[model samples]
Target: MMQRNVGVVFGGVSPEHEVSIISALQAAAALDRARYRPVPIYIAKDGVWYTGDDRLLDPAAYRDLDRIRREATPVMLDPRSYRTLELVAAGGRRFARPARWSVDVLLLGLHGGPGENGGLQGLCEAFNVPYTGSGILGSALGMDKVLSKMLCRDQQIPIVDFVAFRESDWGYHEEAWLDRCEQELGYPVVVKPARLGSSIGISRAADRAALDAAIEEALRYDEKVVVERAVTALREINCSVLGDVHEAIPSVLEEPVRSAGQELLSFREKYLRGGGADGGKHARRPAKQPAGAEGMASLDRVIPAPLPPEKTAEIQALGVRIFQLFECSGVARIDFLMDGTTGQVYFNEINTIPGSFSFYLWEPTGVSFTDLTHRLIDLALKQHHDKNGRVRTYDVNLLSERSLQGLKGAKQRAG
Candidate 1:
C-alpha cells in the first residue's frame, strides 16, 4: 500500500515561532513511516516558504536562522490546485520552472497569528484542501479570547467575567471607561490582548493605577483588549479534546505548576529553558509514567489532577462540549483555571494548535504519537472526501436570461 503524503507546515510570523518549530519537529519525527510520509514545510519569520533536507529536526540549528535560509531551497504551494505543493527552482539562463509535489493532507503546526487565527485555514479552504485542527470559523473564534468567551457564555460554559474594549474607544473615553470597569469588575483584574497567545501582552492589575498601565501594555500587541477578574489563588489545568462537531473525546487533566512570584505562565517560561528558578523549563520536557495513568503520562503532570473524580469528570465533559461548540476537528487543548480553595473551574482558553500537538497527553490513553498523527491525517482525508461529494455549483444560468431584463428595468428606473 502507498503511504499518504502529510505536509507538516510550521514556523510563522507569530510570537510563538520557536514553540511552533519545536512542536512541528516533534510531530514530524513521530509520523508512522509505514502509513504516512512526512514532508516538512518551513515558513520563515519573513514569510518565505522553504522545503528541503535542511528543514529536518535539529534544535541547535535554529539558533542561527540565517545559515538555514542559505542552505534550504525555496518552495510554494500552488493556489490554482490543492493537490500539489510546488517547488520554485531557478533554471540556468532561462525562466524558473514550477516543480510539483503531490500532498495528500496538511498537518498544521502553526501556533498563533495568521497561521492559527484562520489565515492558513482560509487559504486551505480556498484550495478545497483538508487540513487538521479547526475550520476557518472555529480557528478564528478560538484565537480571539473575547469572541470565544462570548460563545462559551452562549453555550453555558463557565468562564471568568471579562470586559472588552477597542483601542479607539479607550483613546476617546479613557477616564469614563476606567470608572466603569472599576465600578463593575473592580481592581485586581487580568488584562490581555484579545487575540494573542502564550500569555503575550497579558498583565495583572491590583489597583486603578495598575489597571491603566496594564491596558496600555495590552494595546501594544492588539487593538482589542479584555480585562477580567484575576484568579489570585489559581490552579491552571488543561485537558486535550479530539474530534469534530458531533463527537469528541477528552484527555486526562494536568495542572501547570507555576513558580513563586509568577502569576501566569509567560512566553519566556513556556519556551526558554532554565529561565525560571523552580525548574519551570524542565517541567515542559517529556516524562515517563506508569500504565493506565491516561494523557498525563507523557508530560510532567500530576496524574488525575488530585481533584475529585466528579470534578474531573465535569472538566472533561466541558472540554468535549467546547470542542463540539467551536466545531473543532482533529485535536485541541482546552485550558481551565480552578480556584485553589473553592475548586471552581473557569474556562480559560482553547489552543487550536497546541504545543507538541498535545501528543504527550494522548500517550497515557494508549494512543502513541504515531497513531495520533495518523488519526489526524485520516480525518483530513475523510473531510476532503465528504466535501467533494457536496453540490458546490448550480447548473442553471440565471445570469444569462436576467441580464437584459435587469438592464432594461435599471434604465427605466434611472430615466
Candidate 2:
C-alpha cells in the first residue's frame, strides 16, 4: 500500500497556540505510519509558515519558537493544485535547499483564530487541497458564540439564554447593556470572548461588579463578547462526532469537573493543571498518559460521564444531528451543558478542530488513535472529490460571440 503524505497544520496567532501545537503533535505521532506519512506544518505566532523533520512535532521544541524557525525551512502551500499540496521553499543563505513536499491531504490541528475560524480552511478550499474538520461555513459559525447560539435556536436545538455585545457598545451604552444582561440573564452569567476557545477569556460573573470586570476582560481578547446564564448545577459533558454530514457517529461522552471555587473551567484548569503545566499542576487526569503525550485528554475528565445508558445514547444522537446540521466533516467535539438538577441538556459550543481531534473519546468505542486519523483523511478526500464532481465553470466564450461594436451599441441603447 502506498503511504500518503498528510500535512498536519498547527499553531496560529491565537491564545490557544500552545494547545494547537500539543494537539497537532499528538495527532502526528498517532497517525497510521503504514498508511500515512505526517508532514509537520507549523504556523508561527507571527503568521510565518515553516515545515521540517519530526523535531517540529515535539512539544518541547516549541519552547523556543524563534530558534526553531531559524533552524526549519520556510515554506508555503501551493494554491493552484488539488489533492496535491506543494510545499515550496527556496534555498537561503544559511540552510541547504530541501525538496518540495507533495501532500495528499491536510490534517488541521488548529484550535482558534484564523486557523480554526475558517481562514485556513478557506485557503485549503481555494487551493483545492483535501483538509479535515468543518468547512468554511461550519468553522466560522462554530467559532462565533453569538451566531452559533442563534443558529442552534433556529434549528430547535436547546441552548442557554444569553446576551451579546461589542466593545463599542460598552463605550457609550455600558449601563444599558449591563442592565439588559442583569435583567434578562440575571446574576451569575458566564462571560466569554465570542470567537475564542480553550477557556482563554472566559469568566463567571456573580454580580454587577464581577459582570463589569468579566465583560471588560473578555473584550480584551475579542471585539464581541457573549454573556450566558450560568448553570448552577452544571455538568459539562463533551461528545466527539466523527465523519461528515452524510454519515457520522458519536463517541462516548466525557464529563470535565471544575475545581471548587473555580466557577467555570478557566484556562488554568483546562491546560495548566498537570504533567508539565506551568507548576506541574494539571487538571483531573483519568488515565496515565505516556510522557510527552499531551492534549485535551491530559486534562481531568470522567470517561463515559457516569450517565445512564439511555441518556448517553440521547446525547450521542444529538451530537450526530449537530454534525449534520453544521455540514461538518472530519471530526468535531460538541460540548454540552447538562443541568444536573433538571436532567436537561443544552448545546454549549462546537470545537470544529477539537484538541487532539478528540481521539481519546473514540478509543473507548473500539477506535484507536491511528484509526481515527485515518478516517479523517479518508473523509477529507471524499469531501474533496464530491466538491469537484459538481459543475464549477462555464465554457462559453461570450466575448467571441459578441462583437465589440455590437456590445457598445447595446450598452448605449440600454443606457
Candidate 3:
C-alpha cells in the first residue's frame, strides 16, 4: 500500500492565521499514517510560503514564527507542468539543497480571508490541483455573506434579515446607510465583515452608538460589511456536511458554548477558550499537550445539541439542502442561528473549510478524525477526476481557420 502524500495548506494573511495553523496541524496529526503522509505547506502572514516537516508539524515551533520560518525552507510552485502540483524550494535557503515535494491532494485548513475565499481555490484550479472543501464558486459564495444570503433567499432557505454595505458607501452616505439599517434591520444588529469566518470582526450592537462603532470596527477587516438583525434569543447550532452535494450526509449538530458577555462568538471564544493554562483567556498554551490532542474538539459544546429528535433531523436536512444549493464538494460546516423561543432555525453562514474540519461533529456519527480526513482527500480526488473529464478545451485552433483569416483581414483593414 503506497502512501499518498497530502499537503495540508494553512496559515495565511488573515486575522485567523494562528487558528488556521492549529486546525492544519491537528488535521495533519489525524491523517492515517499507514495511508497518507502529511506535508505542511505554511503560508506566512506576510504571504511567504514555507515548508519544514519539524517546524510545521510541531505546535510549539510556532511560538517564535520568525525564527521558525528562518529555519524552514521557503518554497514555490514548479511552473513546468500545469496539471502537476510540484513544490520546489525558493532561493536563499540555509541548506545547500532545497527539497522538492509532490502531493496527491491538498487538505485546506485555512480559516478566513483569501485562503478560504475563491482566491486560493482559483489558484488550485489553475494548477489543476485536487483540494479538499468547496470549489472556486462555492468558496466565493460561502465567503461573501451578502451573496450567500441572497442565494439562500433565492432557494427559499431561511436566513436572518440583514443589510450589506461597502466602506465607500458608508463613508459617503453614512446617514443613509445608518437609516437603512435602523429602518430595515433595526437596532440590536450583528455587524460582521462579509468575507471572514471563525467569528472574527463580529460584534452585536444594541443601539445606534454601538452599531456605529461596530460597523467601523468591522470595516477595518473587510471592504464590505453586513449588519444582521441580532437574534436576541439566539441559539447557535452547527452541522457538518460531508461528500458532494449530490451524495452527502450531515453530522450530528453541536452547539458551541460562548463565553460570558459575548453576544456573538469572538475569535478568542471560538479558538482560544478552554485552550490554555489560564483557561485560554489568551492562546498561551503550555509547551506540551496531552497525547491524542484535539483542536476544535476541545470547544465546550453539547453533542446532539440536546435538541428534540425532530428538531435535530430538521436542522440536518437544512444543512444538506444548503450544501447542495451551494454545489459544495468535500466537507463544509453550515451554522444556524435558531430563535430558542420560536424554534425557528435560520441559516447563519457556511464554513467551506471549517476549523479542525469539524471532525468533532463527525465523531459521534461513527466516523473518526482519521476517517474524516481520508474521505475528504478521496472526495477531492473524485472531484478532480470529474472536472478533468469535462470538455474544457476547443479541439480546433481559430488561428488555423479561414474565419480567423477573414477576421484578421478585416481588423488589419480597420487598423
Candidate 4:
C-alpha cells in the first residue's frame, strides 16, 4: 500500500491555543505509521504557519514556542495547487530552490478560532484539497452556540432556553438585557462566548451580579455571548459521531467526572487536573487507570456513561441526526446536558474538531485510535471526490469582448 502524507494542522490565535497543540500532537502520534506519514503544520499564536520534521511531534518541545518557530521551516498553503504547501523561505537562500509538499489529505486538529470555525475549512475548499471534519457551513454552525441552539429549537430538538447578545447590544442596554435574563431564564444561567470552546470563557452565574460579571468576562473573549438557563442537576454526556451525513454512527457515550463543589467544568479540571494533562504529571490519578496523558482522553471519564439502554439509544440517535443536519464530515463530538433529576436531555454544543478526536469514547466500541484516523482520512478523500464529481463551473466565456458588448461600464472595468 502506498503511504499518504497527512497534514495534521493545529494551533491558532485563540485562548485554546495550547489545547489545540495538545490535540494535534496526540493525533499526529496516533496516525498509523505504515499507512500514513504525519506532517506537522503548526499555526503559531501570531498567525504564521510552519512545518518541520518529527521534532514537532514532541509535546515537551512546545514549552518554548519561540524556539520552535526559529527552528521550523515556515510554510503556507498553495492556493493554485491541490493539497500542496509551499515553503515560505523556499528560494530565499542563494543556493536553495523553491519546494512544495503535496499532501493526500488534511487531518485537522484545530479546536477553536478561525481554524475550527470555517476559516481554514473555507481555505481548504478554495484550494481544492481534501480535509477532515465539517465543511464551511457545518463548521460555522457548530462553532456558534447561539446559532446551533436556534437550529435545534427550530427542529424541535430540546435545548435550554438561551439569550444571545453582542457586545454592542449589551453596552447601552446592559440593565435591560440583565432584566430579560432574570425574568425569562431565572437567576442561575451559564454565560459563554458564543464561538469559543474548551470552556475557556464559560461561567455559571447564580445571580444578577454574577450574570453581569460573567457576561463582561465572556465579552472579552468574543463579541457575541450566549446565556443559557443553567441546569441545576447537570450531567454532561458527550457522544462522538463518525463519518459524514450519508452514513454516520455514534460512539458509546461518556460522562466526564466533575469535581465536588464545581458548578461547571473548569479549564483546570478538564485538562490540567486530569491524569493525562501536561501539568498534571504529578497530580494524583484515579485508581485502576494506566499512566500517560492523552489530551482530552486523559481526563477522568466514565465510558458507556451509566445510562439506561433506551436513554443511550435516544442520545446516540440525536447525535447522528445533528451530525447529518449540520452536514458534518469526518468526526465530531456532540455534547449534551441531561437533567439528572428529570431524565431530560438537551442539545448543548458540537465540537466539529473534538479534542483527542474523542477516540477514547470509540475505543470501548472496538475502534482504535489508528482506526479512527484511517476512517477520517478515507471519509475526507471520498467527500472530496464526490464534491468534484458534481458540475462546479461553467465553460462559457462570459467576459469575452463579444459577450460584453451590451454590458454597461465594460470598458471602465476592463481598464
Error of 4 at 407 (Å): 8.3
Candidate 1 versus truth, CA RMSD in Å, comes to 4.7
Output the number of the TM-score-best candidate: 2
Higher-TM-score candidate among 1 and 4? 4
Question: What is residue 19's positional error in candidate 2, in angstroms?
Answer: 0.5
Q: Which ranges of candidate 4 are over 4 A from the true structure?
A: 83-98, 274-293, 401-415
Clashing pairs in 1: 294-364
- CA lDDT, every model vs. true structure: 0.77, 0.84, 0.82, 0.84
lDDT of 2 at 174: 88
TM-score for candidate 2, residues paired by index: 0.93
Give candidate 4's TM-score: 0.91
lDDT of 4 by residue, 84-107 (tens): 544344323222223566777888
What's the TM-score of each model vs. the native? Answer: 0.88, 0.93, 0.92, 0.91
Please give the RMSD of candidate 2 to the true structure: 2.9
Q: How far out, in Å, is residue 208 in model 3?
A: 1.2
Cα misplacement distance, residue 230 of candidate 3 (Å): 1.0
> For residues 1-415, could you state the per-residue lDDT of candidate 2 as single tens digits?
9998999999888888888988888888878789888888888889888888876767788888888778877887675566588988744413323567788898999889999999999989988899988899999998999998998899999999999989988888989999999999997899999999988889888999999999999999999999999987889999999988778899999998787767688776676666455323333222323454466766778888999999999899989998888888888999999999999999999999997788879988999887888888888888899999999886754355355356886656656
- lDDT (Cα, 0-100) at 53 in candidate 4: 73
Residue pairs that clash (backbone atoms under 3 angstroms), model 3: none
